[model samples]
Target: MRVRLKICGAVLAASVLVGSALHASSKPRENVTNASDRDYPAAKLSTLRGKIAYSPGVHAHSLWVMSFDGSHRRQITHAGAHADFDPDWSPDGKNIVFRTERGRYDSNNTGAQGIFVVNTKTLRERQIQPRTGGLFPAWAPNGKRIAFTGLNPTCCGEVIVTSKPDGSDKRIVKLPTAAGECLAWSPDSTKLAFCGHQGDGNWAVWVMNADGSNPHQLTHPRAIEPAGTGGDSPSAWSPDGKQIIYWSWQPAGGELFVVNSDGSDAHQLTHWDGGDEATNWL
Candidate 1:
């Protein structure tokens, strides 16, 4: 259900064979610990950046973490059958939130896949709800609530929803996105930055009240596909809740961008020869 950006072994081999054909690049970033970055906003909680967690080679796999320079590569969770995807760190940096799916698909699912929590230190894992349908869990800055995408049977489409860490008091925050839409908790925990589709059929970054009110669209990019691939992306909230980092696609493929929380002063952050994804703040 979740959009998978990782390369498949088959695709990886082909990409390497044609690496020079689709070359891209990234622009210089001013600061790694600035207000626009997500990690800095959570510094008040002293959360550790910890390891760079991701899938090893494909979408249907376990979670992995690596050192800053890609050394010490290790798989942290051994989730089988249910593929582990969408790894997010708790505000305090002690635990991680992820979803387990039965098959490979975009990050969104129809409530069959469930959200889970794992303690980074002990590797202990548990589901917040024994049987729930959700994916792409965004841990709240205050460490009390979480936001994710789940099925809305009434609309027969996916809707944004939130619940306590214990999976109680669930509330729906309806928005326009099918799947692959990600949620980011504002540093203040009152608002959330997410991706939604625009009238033009392209995905754009958006912000909304965490309680499911006052939803607003922020970014407006011409989707290269000219149809819509999930609209522009709203990846993660800046540590200060002032801006967001998201990914966009062009003829050259996907690149990363950062925009003000109010949808102003957007700037390109990367021009990678391949592509970039919004993961941890860094």
Candidate 2:
């Protein structure tokens, strides 16, 4: 509960680009810090390759694509007043599924959010068929389904839900805590990693089978003092499916952390200012 409240306070006001870092199986690797979320020098931008999809804005976030080095940035979605975020590219790199607060309502009487898909090349965007309510959409590597935190009243509250890309055949991946968020699928698509409250009432990384079985906690970051707070929010898995990257918070600040897929060798990866987040692994 403390961490959940902190999550709300620490949210970036504008937007954040996904940061990438080198990864290895031997140990936790250092993260490559980006100069600025809004600007990258042309010389530096040319040195990096690949594309990154992110939601960029202060009041109204919308999906955008840019090179890994921050070059050739292009808008992908023009949702105007609606906020679009949590862009997850399909494994094949053809489409992206993300959450949009366009035309839905939540339990709090505020506008609810739902997932929508857009073709990376054509820029055509449409809401997922059959309709679904959720945030932080993650595409399974097998290219069959998208997993996200649910908002449907039938879910009873926030929980992990998986459904076809078109939003049909939905299935809830029940968590022991009854609430969860930030779902990431294993590279092999056999398991899911997410963030949820532990028995101690602190948020921690948790993993479960793709079918929603064998749930277990993976990290146990603790608050330094009684009044402080600690928690871990999983971002994504390494390419080989051997490790997971996440964000850990303590009284001092937040940092990136890495742990083995089997819940071993949990350690910090970044030592910079707190608030360092682990996004796409690249």
The lDDT for every candidate, in the order shown, is 0.59, 0.64
Taking the tens digit of each residue's C-alpha lDDT, what string does model 2 give over 162-219? 8888778988776777567767899888899987773444678899998889988998
Deviating ranges (above 4 Å) for candidate 2: 1-49, 107-112, 129-132, 198-201, 223-230
Candidate 2 global TM-score? 0.78
Which candidate tops lDDT? 2
Model 1 Cα displacement at 149 (Å)? 0.2
Off by over 4 Å in 1: 4-46, 66-74, 102-112, 129-132, 176-180, 198-201, 223-226
Assess every candidate by TM-score: 0.74, 0.78
Can you write out model 1's per-residue Cα lDDT over 67-131, one digit (the tens) per residue?
A: 43345766668867557766777777777777776434334433446778877678888776445
lDDT of 1: 0.59
